[model samples]
Target: MDELEFMRGRVYGADHDDAAPRPGRVYAELVGGPLDGLLLDVTDRTERELRGGVVLPTEIGRHGPGGGAVYAPRGPGDRRFDWRGDVP
Candidate 1:
């Protein structure tokens, strides 16, 4: 599996016995832009929150510190979030 798929439901630095998604956790694969291929844990997010999208901090984005990358759900059932752009 690709990096994105492998990281599903898995947090960075966490240990697991298998590739299966962890129980009670949800993840969204980021696509495009600086944060591409990263996974965002969204287990605690409400449907309304998911629909509204999120901004994640990134050190490598165009604006550097104090900047964030925006990502939004691709659709109703999709697990991938598309990069909208960056914000300072």
Candidate 2:
């Protein structure tokens, strides 16, 4: 199957630079732009592990730096991604 099939239409505009969170580092920080210094998801996956964020194509608002995609949580309130290695 194609790589897209594996994503299941969750991520978009991905150019391959995107990567899973490093081990022990659960919080995702904004590298640059207006949202710089911002801490995003708390996924506790290592670089060699799977992506912990479960975002859909429709959920992604735009493409981030280095081909990484940015997505807003579907639920209400502040966006808080699971940091304990829990997948959606």
Candidate 3:
């Protein structure tokens, strides 16, 4: 399956553990890049000891100028994705 489906079916699935990343309603802010202003599905997050980062798995979103929708993976330390609110 695709990244989005895999993430949805596995990572955020009901069968997943409580520590697993829960899906959030709001889109995360993509910091300092062409991806700025573009929204992505807030999949999961890493803990503060893990450097406190947000996870953006494969999801349908605008890529950039002249670029159409695409499935992208923005993990911790990417410097491209950022979340300012409370983390779960």
The number of the candidate with the highest TM-score is: 1
Ranking by TM-score: 1, 3, 2
Better model by lDDT: candidate 1 vs candidate 3: 1
Model 2 over residues 1-88: C-alpha lDDT tens digits?
Answer: 7543344322123343564334464454433332333345444444333233333222222443323333333233333332221112
Q: What is the TM-score (0 to 1) of candidate 3?
A: 0.25
Single out the weakest 10-residue window by summed lDDT for candidate 2: 79-88
TM-scores for every candidate against the unseen true structure: 0.73, 0.23, 0.25
Candidate 1 residue-wise lDDT, 16-51, digit = tens: 564355777887888888777666777888778899
Rank list by lDDT = 1, 3, 2
What does the lDDT read for residue 41 in candidate 2?
44
Instruction: Judge candidate 2 at residue 13 and give its lDDT.
Output: 30
- Each candidate's lDDT (Cα)? 0.75, 0.35, 0.36
lDDT for each residue of candidate 3 in 1-88, tens digit (9 for 90 to 100): 6543334323221343542334554344344322333444353444342345433332232333333322233565442344332211
- Residue 58, model 3: Cα distance from true site in angstroms: 11
* Candidate 1 backbone collisions, by pair: none
Error of 2 at 63 (Å): 7.4
